[model samples]
Target: MNPRTMHSIFLKKKRTMVAIAMLSVGSISAQTFSDFSYKGNDKIYTNNPLKENEFYSPILQGCYPDPSITRKGDDYYLVNSSFSMFPGVPIFTSKDLVNWKQVGHVLDRPSQLKVEKGGVSQGIYAPDIKYNKYNDTFYMITTQIAGGIGNMVVKTKDPAKGWSEVQKLNFDGIDPAIFFDDNGKAYIVHNDAPPKGTEQYNGHRVIKIWDYDLEKDQVVAGSDKIIVNGGVDLSQKPIWIEGPHIYKKAGKYFLMCAEGGTGGNHSEVIFMSDSAKGPFVPATNNPILTQRYFPKDRRDKVDWAGHADLVETPDGKYYGVFLAIRPNEKGRVNHGRETFILPVDWSGKYPVFENGLVPMKPKLKLPEGVKNKTGKDGFFPNGNFTYIDKLTDKNLDFRWIAMRGPRENFITSAKNGVKVNPMETNIKALAPVSALFHRLQHEDFETSVSLDYKPKSEKELAGITCYQSERFNYVFGITKKDKDFYIVLERTEKGESKLIASEKITLSKAIKLQVIGERDEHQFNYSLDGKNFKNLGGPVSGDILSTDVAGGFTGSLIGLYSTSSNDIKP
Candidate 1:
């Protein structure tokens, strides 16, 4: 059979596998998930809904940034950066490229991820997952910013199963991606600072390529070379040229990278060369994908778009997955950088992201015959949807995540929900806390939970936290204030904690605590009975939970938090 014809058949088979996997995913969840991690029976209803023949542009949302895609024949896998959050490097699978199901984290085991002592933003960064057909193995290469483990790679025949131990690479850079040539030679592409004293300006980075030894899983000695410097044009003084990936197509080598930092000026630029390690030349029409040129107030605006990876389908079509932010009405990024996809017009000499230059529409038309299964079956949810997790499933949902340690470390299934054993470290500490977090997915939303707890002492507290990081967050929970139990709301900004409000409460029964996020503000409420809610704090500014104010690469996380080192005095 012809290669193209075989790929078509393989796609059909893979599509069928996806359907079966979606329908039967919950049945096999126990084999993958740890049950009842912090009891987040959440219901999120966003305002963006899909229209006919359309799906959401952000195939994955809420801090899922720096998306890299890889293809093995008809099957596709996508991965993202996971900084400090334990079980780093979230990996997902898709057949149609629209619907995605998280197979699991790439660094799922404690031995694979050692971020326990690193800051909240110092774990995995910009992981690139690529399938090497030469060995029939998948390689996930990334930079671990913690524990002195710099650039690393892990391999596995199947992604759904657990991955191998980390193979630390001998390099000092960020965002390392491995590319395998057709002749079985592999190369490593990454962004690094220019050779010492060669720095012409700040943020002056270069893209370098090295011959990768397949047998040793190391970059070949003395084979590294600089392919691109100072981005597309030297006169422009381009900043932060990073997140590089190489592709070999039609006997030509393409090196795509994100330029101008990760904020508003961010963009994807392309360069081509005849050889893998090359004197590559920038494309005449560069910045193949960007949202910075559009007006800031454009309707349904998407901004800070860059850090992309591309993949070609079996039918000769191309798509680019990148990170972009959807700022709230107050012009703050509470949603952080999300994963968005756009079709590529690669028919020309250069691949341009179609509809990528303009203000992005929330929806994309589905491929010819692929049905949209988002929010249904086992695929990841997007657009306008209401997701309800009842805290009763035998297996934990893949959506639940923790920081610095595995969710299993502090959570246990008991009494129809998760029992969080309060850790010595508090939410304000750099170390791991006893909390399970779900991303703050929507700008305007309400997240509520029932907590049956009576503080035995002032040090023990259990409640909900709207956290941007350890330095900036809000802690609302039950704590004993001098022999009296009270529900207190505390705000921590830049490592300083201030009491926002406190209510003396009788600990007679289970109480429902809720946090309502309304784009610019958040409201804390409590209900003695499940339905009757009384506001604890009228409204608090959401500035602390925004990336713009907090100054981090991550978005706000809504955590079911419990801690034994409580320091908030109310």
Candidate 2:
């Protein structure tokens, strides 16, 4: 989760966490990649393992943020914001919430997403998923900040069977959520600007409710009204009152929203109303969930906590899934914001996130009648884990994603690897390029892959990218210069690219490229015969790859990329 998007919320507004791709090209210049491995070495994960009934805090590790959850009987489905990544909205399934597995994406086709031409940070924003029991269907609504598509919705009877095409909504705002009343009435709630002239402060926003037409998939015209003005209190001129969701509890309406932007001061506040469209009053104890009040220097801190969605268990327990940043030891927003879960204490009139006001802990007690199955059997790995992908004709894992488009743009089948046809557009291109990525899931991790390729000219290059966005990233690749082969490490910050280091290497058969991250520092290395790796860019600062420094809504992606439009030189 990018606090920068939090800025967009205010204005409007991994771990070895590497999405690295492995390239294996033939000696004759036929590009193929294989034998890739990623190892998470964070002490918090390696030293501690889940007990008999315990699990980690971040059930879905890596850049899975802006979490929204819904329950269909014993089945629970969760989704997260994917920004410009193709197959937008990473969807997951869980029986116990603690053990979650990805069920593919909501927007898996290009026709459903119009983000190929926009910048990486300008695509899909906050995505809210809900279940309308009235129709026996699941709904996902979000703001596509690019390609002229504002707010839209997609539906699916079963998430595993893919979703419907984008049904453009008539509302105008971000983070739109749908609620279905037991009487079969439906309402739409979202964050929008105040009435034309009533605009007060810079970031003053309002929560508006609309009578949604379920049959037509549109909001009722002239049926919109502002519910909460400038958050819990108008006098303070609150900023970014967004990510609103409405719930009916025992004949009362409960409206919850994220306030105070998406930075260190981010928070979640709740309001109550007897009716869905009537005047909603703020709870006396607002800010029911936040880490802003906690001391900044607290140990194992979990900051920037807000933008939450709630779901009730069959046993009457309430849980919230929200976005929060786990800063590195250097206090930098490292590996971007991730999805975290906590029990909600709704025994009172209003629900409160348990232990949310204090320094957050990593261990969570398992819910009754559920076993922790993380890091095994395909449930998303949290705490610490390793992933090995031997690239084949079908390409890597299902989670290996591309930006702005599909992976078919370049990947083909090889004997034991993927045959990649480099794209004219490089990694820096805003359009679809030839690269495969995985999210950086941990603070300290090591990723390596072997490449067997011979560049024919200076135009062809292939390597790994430690990418935050197209504007800010580190590209390390092998290219031909004049008559020699060289591996170049280049860093780009805010659109400015600078060559960090490069090395001339003798290509015997294949070479192993590796990147090791120890918190704020990352090192790039290469080995000719598989062992005795030599560092290329020795300990480069990872500040540019953070959400705090780069200013975007996603995490750093490690990519195995092949591009014919190579520009970096040794």
Best by lDDT: 2
The estimated TM-scores of all candidates read: 0.91, 0.94
Candidate 2 structure quality by residue, lDDT tens digits, 1-570: 332232223222010111122233333256667888898887776666668878888777678889999999988999989889986898999988988888788887666788888787788888989898888999999999877889999887888767887888887878899999889999889999998999999999999999989899999999999888998889988999999998878789999999999898899999988998868899999888898887778877788999999999988889999999889888877578889999999898999999887778888888888888887898877777788888874535768988897676557667768766686798778898878898998899999988888888888898899999888899988999999999999999988899999888888777889999997999999999899989997899999999889887788888998888889988
Q: Name the regions of candidate 2 deviating beyond 4 angstroms.
A: 1-28, 46-49, 393-395
Give candidate 2's TM-score.
0.94
lDDT of 1 by residue, 1-570 (tens): 432344345445644654554455332211111121222111222344555687878888789989999988778999999899976888899999988999878887767788988877788999999999888999999999988899999998888776778899988889999999999999999999999999999999999999999999999889999999889997889999999999888999999999989999999999999999888999999888888887777877789999999999999999999999988778989878999999999887788999888788887899888899987888988765556665656356777889998776666555466656677799987787878898877777777777877777787788889989999999988888887988899999998888989989887777788887776888999887778998986899999999989997998898888877888777
Q: Rate the local accuracy (lDDT) of all candidates.
A: 0.83, 0.85
**Lowest lDDT block of 10, candidate 2:** 10-19
